[model samples]
Target: MEENNLIKKCQRGDKEAFQKLISQYHPIVHKFLVKITNHEQTAEDLTQETFLKIIRNIEKFDIEGKAKFSTYVITIAKNAYIDYLRREKRAMQNTPIPENLNIEDVHIQVEETVVNKLYGQSILENLEGLSEEQKIAIKLKYIEGLTLKEIGDQLNLETKTVKSRIHNGIVRLRKQLEKGDER
Candidate 1:
């Protein structure tokens, strides 16, 4: 059976159907968690938690104009991961930095950690350099997950104009990334 149909069955309180649906989606959910968490065991635990929440809250889900099953599951997984990060950050903040740890080693680790973040920031800065309409259009269409038509509606632009903005923004962002790589 299709996942959507299986999800509908599960939502209707069929235990066997829910179990089957969970089994099908478990690997996908785990892989996504692993990518974000970078820990296999933690990913497995989070994946289980995600499915448990889904099963518990499935009744609240409306099929009408709702996001796809995978998108909904991913949003839940992303939220759970963000919550985990917040807790981890709080715990770390409560701990004192060890004075005995070599400053050079800490610096090296920080550099490695920040390079990717810097790359992303550079791309964002380039996007911000675009015309206001282009930047807003791209952000609505890509970051906000709006369709081209939706972006057009929100921006009071033609669909083609929205598409052009997104296309131009993506091209500029790519160029920025490329220039940074050359550096």
Candidate 2:
């Protein structure tokens, strides 16, 4: 059956349709999660969670919507991963440091974490200054660790186009970052 028909069946509360839909999209979604999280087990958990949310919200998905179904699924997967990251960050914040750790060692670790956070924040801010096309390309390539071919497929662009965007974006970012450093 076509995707629209499958989605229609899913919307009508067809269990078999939902299962088929999951089977169809699970691999790409799982691969994306694995790339973004860099952890296979976490990717598996997030992939499962993403599909569960999809099952719950399938009725709301419009067959007439502009986004392709694949895009929709990827978006849901991204949001699920983001939510997981937030929960993990909160858990880290709430957890007490181990008593076995030396005070100076803990202090050094905390300092390193803070510096990393600041540098990461600056990169994110700079990313906002990029064109939407370049920003997406750069994030998928560097942050999510997706290959050029994967990014091209996801964005429906040529591999050459994706590579050019990433390279140019990085050059611009490097210039911007150097200016900031000099200040």
Candidate 3:
């Protein structure tokens, strides 16, 4: 069956269609979650949660929108991972830190921030030479975690145009990084 037909059937509460859809998109969601979480078990659990959310709320999906099904699913997976992080943070905050751990031991946190800032600064410097469109596309796709269609909508451009800009921007960044390495 066509994807649209499958989606329609799933939306109508057809369990078989929903299962097929989940099977089709599960790997994509799992891979994306793994990238974000860096843990196989967490990614697997999140992937299942994403599909569950989709199954429960499939009626909310807009079939005629510019966003593709995969994009929508990926967005859900990203949001799910973010929610997990927030929950983890809240849990950590509620738990008391051990008295054996001194304030001096927390220097690792400051060092991590400094390292992140240095990398961020380097990336910003490399991005300076890119065209405005390229820069915006790259930032929206990677930093802001927006889909290509979402970025296109924001920039009033086509999806292909946004994708091209991101591709060109990445190439330029790679060349810049290589030059920096050589220096």
**TM-scores for all predictions:** 0.53, 0.64, 0.58
For candidate 2, the 10 contiguous residues with the lowest summed lDDT are 124-133
Task: Report backbone clashes per prediction.
Answer: 0, 0, 0
| lDDT score at residue 34, model 2, on the 0-100 scale | 79
Cα miss at 2, model 3 (Å)? Answer: 0.9
Alpha-carbon local distance difference test for all models: 0.73, 0.84, 0.80
Q: Can you tell me which runs of candidate 2 are displaced by over 4 Å?
A: 103-139, 142-183
Clashes of 1: 0
Report the candidate with higher TM-score, 2 versus 3.
2
The prediction achieving the highest lDDT against the true structure is 2
- Residue pairs with backbone overlap in model 2: none
Residue-by-residue lDDT tens digits, candidate 2, 126-168: 7757765687688889877789997877776789999999999
Give lDDT: candidate 3, residue 65. 78
- Local error of candidate 1 at residue 26 (angstroms): 0.6
Itemize residue pairs with steric clashes in candidate 1: none
Local accuracy of candidate 1 as per-residue lDDT tens digits, 50-164: 8889999997777664466766777677667667766877998999978799989989987975685576666565764666556656655655577898655544458998898
